[model samples]
Structure formats: C-alpha cells, structure tokens
Target: MVFARYLTPAAECGGLGLQCLGVGWQQVSRIQFDGRVIDCYGLMMIVRGTGWFVWGDLPRQRVPVQAPALFVVFPGVYHAYQPDAGGWSERWVLFNGPSAHTHEVLGTLDRDAPVMVLQGPLDGMERVFESLFEAADSSSPHRDVVTSSLVHRLLAELLAVKATTDVARVVRHFDEQATGPLSIGEHARRLGMDTPTLRREMFRATGTTPKDYILRTRLSMAQRLLLTTDRTVAEIARCVGYSDAAYFTRLFSRRVGQAPSHFRKVGRPRGRDG
Candidate 1:
C-alpha cells in the first residue's frame, strides 16, 4: 500500500473561502478495511476495485462498477464495505476543516451514487493523489488555499474528460485576445463574422461580451506589470493595449479602487515595484 498526506494552515484560506484541514491518499486491499466502516467527509477515487458499500441496516449496494470510479462521502455518513471475494484495490483521500466544500459542490449526486467514473483508466492519478497528500503533510503558509485550488483543478479535469468539447478554439481565441486592445468590431472582422452575430455566438459560448472580456484581461495584465516590472505607468499602459496613459489610469483606478502609483506603492513590495 502507498500512503501520503498533506496538511493545510489557517492563514492562506481565502478566495473560494474554505480552510482545508488536510488531504491524504492510500492504496490498499480488502484486508486493510475488513469489516470497518470509515467515517469522514471527503472523497475517494477507486483506481481499481470491485466492491460494494454497506450502510447501517441497509443491504450492501454494489459500487457502480467502473475503472477509476470517484466517490464523495459526506461527514458522519455510516459506511462499511469490502471487496468481492475476488478482492479489490483502491485509492482514497480524507479531508476535513471548516473550508472543505467538496460535498457542497457535488451535492447533486447521492453521497453514495458514485460521483464520476472515468470511461477509461487515467494517467497521472498518482500525481493528483500525491499532490493532495503533500499539501496535507506540509504547514507552509497558504497550503490550505493551494490544496483547495488543486482539488478544484482535479475535479475540472475529470469533468472535462467526461464531456469533451471543441470549445478549445474559443478558449484559445479568448486567451489570444484577452489582453489585446482589439475592439469588438475589429475582432468580429478578424473572425469573419458580423458584429451582432459574433457577439451572440461569443456570449453563447463564453457567457461574456468580447469587449468586457478584453477589458478585464487587459486590466489583469496591467496589474501584473505594475507589480512585477519597473516599466513606467505609460509604458505598461501601452503594453496592455491602452495607448493613452491617462485613460489607462482612469480605467485602472475605477476598477482597482486606487490610482496606479498609489496601488504600486502600497500594494506591492518596494523592490518589486516597477
């Protein structure tokens, strides 16, 4: 059996607003859990297994058989199980803390319904498992935040594989134009679609107007440059697609709640200030 653990601290719990207690992984056989009911609110992904789950007083329910089956168990739920006579192998993780939101995000599925099962075996299962494990074992600042972020990423990958799509083209386009100072009309012409049609399709596909998305992206780039580079505000403005420094300052101040110079001086370390 292989075992790993990751521990998170309190200070770094921000953004998604959850404090991760810890994450752990274990690969074990039936003998390890013979006649034991593990209790916790976390997740379990069966890399290899043929087993059933037994709740108190309930007849055993065969785990919906699948290679790479992922299960989510809520806190306090009664659970006990063993692999079929042939025996089984599986991987699992246990996490807890006020910031844990695994159960909440996956609430649509019955706790025992088996959240997802990859159609085929997946590579990198160990990396995912170990990442969470290391996060649980460490006490570095913001470990919990980082662990929670990784958890979301893992779930996203699973979902993406399960529902493959051609939206890659749209995503690529968004990435390319996000920080560019291209107008919606120019973007529509470049994509060979009329403005209204392009707007409709972009909104339908990405849920945001191209102009708004581009503005936000440019703002983000401007912020990064402000924090990490020594470029003048005017130069950074042009780099992020704002030809007019004053206009850029207005936009930045409106969105970030501070003047560009003040933001740089107060928000970033002096050495990092550009």
Candidate 2:
C-alpha cells in the first residue's frame, strides 16, 4: 500500500519557520532515489524488512539496515537507498525550513551520520508518524501549523529513543502502555529495580514522576482524540484509561483548565461532525 500527502503552506505558516512539504508511507518490493540531489530534508523510518543504503559522492559508503531503523535525507546530499529483494515498508516526511538547519546545528540531526538504529518500543514513535500523516491532510484545519509541530515532536521522540538508556526504555514503556492499566511498582519490578530507583531514574531523565508522566501521556492522547475523533467524551475517557466519565471530566478540567467538550468545540475543525 502506498499513500502520500503533499502540502503547500499558507502565508501565515511561514512565520513558524518550519513547513512539512509532504508526508507518505509505502510498502514496496523495491524503491530508490538516486542521481539527483534534492533540495529538502526527508525523514524515513523503516517499519519492516532490510535494506541497503549508499550516500555521498566518489567515496560513498554502503550501509545495511534492518527494520525499525531511521535515516535522514539532507538537502543537496548525494544519497540513495533501496530495500533488499524481500522489500520493506517505510513512513517518511519531507520538510524544509530554517528550523531544519537549527536542528542540525544543535546535533539533533547529524548530516555526517544520517542513519541510526531505533531502539525500544516503537509504538509511541509510530503513533507520532500516524498523527503527522493525519494532520497533513488537506481537509484538516491548520495543516501547516499542526504538521510542523508534529515534525518537531517527532525529532524529540527520536532523540529520546536513540539515547538507549534504562530511563529511555522506561519512558517508551509508559508511552506504549499509558492507555492501559499500569502501576509504578509493577513496572519497576519488571525492570528488576525497586520503586524508588525507578522513581529516581524517571525523575532524573524527565524531571517528572512516573505517575505524573503517565497522567500527562494519557491526557495528551485524550486531547488528540477530542480534536480528531468523533467519539463521545465517555468513550474517549475510557479509551485513555479513565473508566469513569465524570471522574475523567473532573481530572481533565483540573489539569487542562477546560472541559473536554469545550476544548473539542473550540479546537475541532469547522463543519466536522461530532
């Protein structure tokens, strides 16, 4: 299956200094981009299968990659990549702006070494890509602004996963399981550590307690559902791990400073149904 969306930024989107030119995902027997130096940045995530990549001029290096790997396509760089005979599935985003250069300067994206083996539970990263694809839809309101924010978020999440530390694993675990029943004690035990050690590690890495992080993660999902889906508040509440609708409302109101219904009304695209 192959699907892609290309976006043209509105005038107002330029001030943000970031624009997502396109978003796409494909399942293919083979694919290649070679011979021409492109003028925009591309982020590609290999969802399945193995591949070989060759980049640079004259003295290029050929790299073998497995599934769940990520690679960057720098503007004007000589690069080419293709899956093995078995093929692979990939999700990619095309973007360009001053912000991309800033990330390069900050060491968030290294042009010299463009690919990294992604580690830990990838569910969270996949969700971000899915959200980016959805937000780039032409029918979605504020396409440019939303896609730009999602791109930034994608980078941050990528960095966290690449850290490859115990805390990073813990965070990925929470990210994947936040909508289900969870307990700090159970998680710590699973990690072969005491609750205090887990707590300390989480605090040092994220500056937030595990409990609070879970709460924030759940609420973030709740907000996304509220804006993008037609599900009722009760359903969304349950979907995000709150069984009691009234209690969920109370917590959401306290933390988010607005009722879910009100937030949806203000945030949902015009003319969109329930």
Candidate 3:
C-alpha cells in the first residue's frame, strides 16, 4: 500500500470547496474486502490483472472483469472489489468535492451502475492521476482548487471517451465521406444502419446530427476554397455539391457570420464588431 494523505489544518478555517482525501497505488497480491459503504467518492482504475466487482442489492451479481478499467464508489454506496489471486495493480483517488456531484449529474458516475471498462490502454489516464496527486501534494497556495479542477477535467475526459468504441466505424465512414455529396439517409445506408439509428448514434458520439455534421463538413470545404482559390462563389458552391450559389451563400452567412464575398476579402468570417 503506497499512499499519501492530505490533512486539512484546523487554522485554515473552512475546508476547500473540494478536497482530495487521499491518493495511492496498491499492488493487491492478497487482499480481501467484504464491502463497505463509505462517505467519500472514490474512483479506482486498474492498471494490471483481473478482478470482480460485487455490488447491488437483490440479484447481487459478481461482474468478472480485467484491467484497463475504472470503477467508481459513490458516496454512501455499498461496494466491494478485489483482484483475482493472480493479483492486480490499482491507482485510486478518494475525494470529497462538489465536482463529484457534478459527475453524477453528467451521467459520468452512477451510484447503481458504478463500473466503466476502458476501451484501450490506460497510460494516458495513469499520467493524469499522477499529475493530480502531485498537484495535491504541492504546498502552493490554492492547490486544493487546482486538484479539484483536475478532478473535473479528468471526469470530462472520461465521459468523452466512454462509449467511443461503438463510434469508431461511424468515424471511419465519416472521414471517407468528408468531401462527398450524400444525404443523411444515404450516408446511413453506407454504414449499414437505418437513418434513425445512425442519427442517434452519431449524435451520441459527436454531439451533432448527421445532417448538421455533413453541413459542417461542406462549410469547411467552402472555407478552404475561399482562402486558397480564386474560384467564384458559384463555382466553389458547385464543387461542394450545392446547386445554387445564392442558397449556399445564405447558409454560409448564417453559420459563418459573414457574407461569402466579404469573407473572401477579409480572410476570415466577420464578427458583430466587424
């Protein structure tokens, strides 16, 4: 058990809005935990070996899993986890902070379903935790605030990566069609998915609808043309698959905040000040 503690000084007055109670790494060669409900929110990431997370009421299932995964212990949740006899290595953070509740609100952490299996290698996340620990250990003023900020940043990145596996194929297909002319339904068919399913999945992965994504791609092409070529707006519009120059210019002006001709002159989209 390699652990470091951060004890708040009484003279420091009220606590930092958020605080890291402890940070550590442990090689679990022989450890058995019956389970305990704790007050602080915890996030543990497995660096090696396999394990089982046993939790919940009624059904009480034991989820057999391996490394490169993270599990959270929401405050007041009864959770027990242990490594297989082969053993495991773990990195963890025990924190009590308002940001922890923000994690729950963002659906990044759930009290009922507390496990998230990482899709790939965790070297990047390992470094993040190390930096977080270092920040907490430093004696700099407002280091507590810094640690809390790092915690929220880590949670945001984790949520961004969650469920990214399913979108790999969609992303591949999207890249292939980066300059093509295809309707949302046609693009959906290219990926062997119905329009609605693709729409939902794309939105989940990218936070934009299929139609909006294609439009953005098209607009990017138009921006490139305006920057690099002497082509007329009508010619550039046709190259990006727009039939009418007027409609394309209107749409471009709406999204880019400048008339196409003006953008071509200014080398950038104009703002309200412009």
Candidate 4:
C-alpha cells in the first residue's frame, strides 16, 4: 500500500521568487522538508489514508482517516512523522518568494502553536497541484503569471479553511447579524436560549464564554472597519457593540495585544490575533 503520493515532475514550478514542489502517491514512501527547522512554513494536504504528526515534543497526534487534513509548519519548529500501515498519501507544495503573503497569513497560526487541522477534503488539491506543476514545467511566457495566480488560489483556500474552523459559531452569528450591531442578549434570544444557557453552550462547544465570544466577534468587525473605512474609533466601537470607546479600546488591547489604532495600522489578516 502506498502511503505517500509523489507528484509528477510536470507539477513543479518556479517563479515569482516562489518554487512549487509536490509529490503524489507514487513519489515516495515518505517525505520530509527543511529538516524540522523552527521557522519554515509548509502547506500539506492529505490526499488519502491516515497518519500522525509529531511536532516540538508534542505527543504524536493521529490525523483522521479519509478526512482532508491541512498542516501549516512554522519556521524553527521541529516536526516528524510516522505513516499508518496503509501509508499516508498526501500532496504538498513548498514555495518561497517575493509575494510570500501566504507566510504572513500563516503567521497567525504560528503565533499560538505549530499544528492546526483544517476541516475540509483534499479532493480539489490534486488538480490545483497539477496545474501549478504544468505551469512551472512549461516554457510559456505567461508561466510565472499563471503559476502565481494558481498559488494565490491555493493560499486563498488555505486561509478560507483556517478562518472557517477558527471562528465556528461566533462567525455564524456575526454573518447573520452583519448588517448591524448584535447584542449578546439578542443573539442568545435568537438561538432560543436564555443568556446563562447560551453562555454554557458556547463554552461547551468552543471553549470560550459567550460574552468573550461576542466581544471577539464584534472586535473582529471593528478591526475590519478600522482598516478599510474612515470611521472614527467611537463609531466603530458602537458598530460592534461598545458604546464606550475607551472601554472598547481596553478590551481590544486585552484580546488583540494592541490598541485599535495600532491594529488598524497592522491590518486584520485572519486567524487568531493574540
């Protein structure tokens, strides 16, 4: 049984200061990159089978079989692997270049820890990898442009999945209430539960209290307004649920580690802030 798929040579591409490398099931029995450095970042999708990942002395964690798992490895981190008896089959792309915003976007994950499991299938990754490989192997004048666009698409998918799993229910409520401010009491009412019960459930499901969840939700909105609009801090605060700008600033700084103004300067990229 082949555990790892070796990507075809045609799928390898180099340009835009980024080089894309991939392996399909036939490529090798196993693979490793950068020899477990602390700061290297990598995007890997398991195309088939079950496997385990061990990083930074953490116990080897089993990756669910048949479920697509996305892994982001940060620089200076040490990672090792052992495939299941069926062997872990996967597709991986490694690239570093000028427009390496993927690295920055991935930084959000890096701030907290080294391992994250994205909730999605690896079904579409093979095609994307194939296209990138072909573009790289071609001598066409538009090769870099085409490969860059594909890389962007791939990165977008990675970030999208990361965002989806990160916020969960809070994000659901935020989307439903995107048009205006949503009070915590009001949100609880909408969910058919009282404030206390809602708080309990939120904690049970997400490991965060309802109040903190709502605060983070609104703060996330406030962050967007700060970066993209000319809205005053007070207005943005009110838009998210805080009537007191000073209080909001305190809360934002507590959770985000920076004042709202500073966060605006830094911009909201995605993933956990602190």
**Best candidate according to lDDT:** 2
lDDT of each residue in 1-274, candidate 4, tens digit only: 3332222223334345443443223322444432365433466666556656656546533333333565655556566654566666566655555456555745434433344455544335566777766776677776656766776667766666555554454446645574356567887666434677567656755688766666666777877788889999989888887788899888788777788888888875433653
Counted clashes in each candidate structure: 13, 0, 0, 24
Give per-residue CA lDDT, model 2, range 1-274, as digits (tens): 8889998888778678778899999997976656557899988899899997777778986778888888888998988898998999999999888888888865557676677667667877899999987787658677788998888888778767755545666787788877878688987766545788678778877899989888888888988999999999999999999999999998887788778999898874221112
Off by over 4 Å in 1: 6-8, 11-15, 32-40, 55-60, 64-66, 85-87, 96-109, 124-126, 161-274
Structural similarity to truth (TM-score) of each candidate: 0.45, 0.58, 0.57, 0.46
From the highest lDDT down, the ranking of the candidates is 2, 3, 1, 4
Candidate 4 accuracy as TM-score: 0.46
Off by over 4 Å in 3: 9-17, 120-123, 163-274
In candidate 4, stretches whose alpha carbon ends up further than 4 angstroms from where it belongs are 1-18, 21-35, 38-40, 57-66, 101-111, 121-126, 139-142, 169-274
Residue lDDT tens for model 1, 104-217: 444322443434555533565557766767766666666767777776655555555433221344445766877675678887765534677567656766778877667776
Each prediction's whole-model lDDT (CA): 0.60, 0.81, 0.74, 0.59
Give candidate 2's error at residue 222 in angstroms. 54
Compared with the true structure, the alpha-carbon lDDT of candidate 1 equals 0.60
Error of 4 at 89 (Å): 1.5
